[model samples]
Each structure stands twice: as structure tokens, then as C-alpha cells.
Target: MPDLFHPQMMGYLESLVPQRHEVMLEMEARAREIGFPIIGIAGGQFLYQIARMMKATRIFELGSGYGYSTAWFARAVRENGGGVVHHVVWDEKLSSQAKDYLGRLGYSDIVQFHVAEAVETLKATEERFDLIFNDIDKVGYPASIPVIKERLRPGGVLLVDNMFLHGSIFDPANTSEAVQAIRTTTKLLTQDPQFISSLIPIRDGIMLSYYVP
Candidate 1:
């Protein structure tokens, strides 16, 4: 997938990023080997920064592939003394792999990994979170807005990945469901009085929506 920044710009930004943990390095290698779509260093670092800034105690991740992004949040929560991250994935095998990865990162105790439909899992829980990270299937983005808004605590954060979807959202002619859903969701976020939203043009782009209640 094409990155949002130019090659040189991305390289320069990447150079400024601090070195990662050995486990993170290994995870990156694994993702590369599996051709997985991880948020990578830029996005992961940003997530950590946001979580730390908010002093986030409880977080919920809509779609956790192998716990890469979850690792970043988990680490942030640990540094803040204590917290829990609820991660949902549809595949049991993937959930198991995610557990192993979090275990390697020593975040297994801090993260709750669930293998189930993302929306259903959220609906079943009575938890309110300090942060909601949405990286689910793009076609379902719009559907998650009201649900997440309801569950997010006042002044909490909502971070949505793949907002650019390989730059598909910019092409007005593309009427694909994924593109339309994301566009509509973005519009809703921007138009909603409760959310202060902005598009972070980072890796694949991410939408940062802050809930004001």
C-alpha cells in the first residue's frame, strides 16, 4: 500500500522516531513476513503518545489483528501504573496469536483479547473507555460511530485507522462500500457537535476524534 507521505518525508520522520523494543522489532519482522497490515512505527508511536497524554486507563480496540497496535496501548497503560485494554478479533486463531504476541510483550495480563464480532462484543460490554481505537473493516466504520460515541467517556479519544484506505477516500468516483462508509463516517465525525475531529495524514491516514460529551 502507498504511504501518505513521500518516501523522503517518511524516511525523515522515521529517523526521528526512537528505537523500539526488541520484541517490537521482532513483531515488525513477523508482520513483514506475513504481509500483515500493521500500523507500523509512526502510527504505533502516535498511539502511545495519545494514550500517555490522556492518562488513559481503559481502552477498547475494535479490530486487533495480532495485537501489534494493542501492544502500544498496553505499554502506555502499564507506564501509567495500571490499565486494561479490551481487544476484539473475529478469528480464534488470530486471537490466540495475538495473545502470544502480547505475552511476549508482557502485556498479556493487561489486555483482554476476545474472539468475536467487534460490534457485538462492544454491545455486550457495559464498559466505558478512555480511548476507543477503531481499525475494523472499513465498510462498517459508519455503523460504529454512534456505538463508540455512547461507550466513550467524556473527553476521551477515538482513533480510526485506514481512514485513507490506500487513498481511495479521495476519489469521488469510487463508490465502493468501504470508501463510502469511511467518507460518511468522517463526515459524521466532523459534523457532530460532540466530537472535535481531525485527519492525521500519517501512515494510510488516521482520524483522531475527541469526544467532548
Candidate 2:
């Protein structure tokens, strides 16, 4: 997926950027302390910069873990005078934790936290978005791509985190669902006519795809 830099190099690069929101800072700490590989601060910053650059208004996130990336998306849209971001966090405990953190940052008014399967939430919602983040069970990624692309406004972006899955996709001993999803999604994305895509390897690799129409 990503071949830009090694993980350590990316971490160094992450240190040079401004620190994340307090909530995400805490999440970063927790991710490190508990060995949560899903937390990607640099990857989040990359997405954040894209959102900021696009002046994203309405945003949506699938599988927002403790609101780390969601906070960045919220900040990007909020700085533009209070845009909304619907964050779908599947884990109840984690969702509660994220809500508390977002509330502390006064982003409570803009974030709609959903404690349900992200696909289900996406199916049920009627709102469109300017940006979308996909970070769910990797096996579910390919199936969700069409759903994600449909909801995005023209020129909107869909950012997929953990695109490499710790090199497991290429590891001979690994035969996991996540790996399969990564392969399938990557293949689908690279061949898609509507999207111009690229994979940036920072900590784990992130797939950035845009809708040109």
C-alpha cells in the first residue's frame, strides 16, 4: 500500500507537525500505552491537512476509534465556522470515551456519535458529506467503497487508514481477512475509473482517493 517511508521515519515527521487536539493527544497516549496499532497520529494529520485544504464542511467517519481522527476532521470543519461531522464509532465503551473528550473540546455540538455498525449507520443516514474516513474491520472495506463514494460531494475525499495491515498482506504466513480486504480494496481502487488514488506509507499506510466528478 505505502512505500514512502519507514514507520520510524514517519514518527519523526509526525513530531514536527503541530500536536493533535487534546482528546486525540490522550488517545495517542492510550494507544501507545495499550499497544493499539490502530492509532495513527501522522496518518490522521495527513487526513487533517487534506480536510483543511479542501475546506471540508460536512464530514463522516466510519469506525472512529475513540475519536482520534474524528477530532481532526471536526477541527478542520469547525475552524470554518462550525461545520458538522457525523462520527460512527462501533464500540460502546470507546464511543462513550470519545464523546467525553470531544465534549471537553467543545466539539460536542458538531459531532454526532453513533454506537452502531458504521455500514448500518451509513445506510440509515440521509446526510451527504464533504469528507469521509474509512477505518473499520478491513474485510468490510471493499464492500463499503461504493457506499462511501456515493455519499461524497463532487471533489470529496475518502481516506482509508491502515492500508498495509502491518505488512501482513505480503507476509507468506498470514492469511487473514484484513489482508484480503486490503488486497481487494487496493486492486479495486487502483482500477477505478472515477478515482485518482495514491497510497502514502507513514506508520501503516493510508489510501487517499478523491471523486473528481
lDDT of each: 0.90, 0.82
lDDT of 2 by residue, 79-195 (tens): 877788888876899989889888988789889989899977886778778888888888899999888877888888888888888778778677787788898899888789888
- Backbone clash total for model 2 is 0
Where model 2 places Cα greater than 4 Å from the true spot, the runs are: 1-7
lDDT of 1: 0.90
Best by lDDT: 1
Cand. 2 TM to true fold: 0.91
Report the number of clashing residue pairs per model.
0, 0
For model 1, residues 1-213, the per-residue Cα lDDT tens digits are: 986457687567667779988888888899889899999788999999999999998999999998899999999999988889998999998899888888988998899988899977887789899999999999899998889988999999999999989988889899999999988998999999999999998788889999996
TM-score of each: 0.95, 0.91
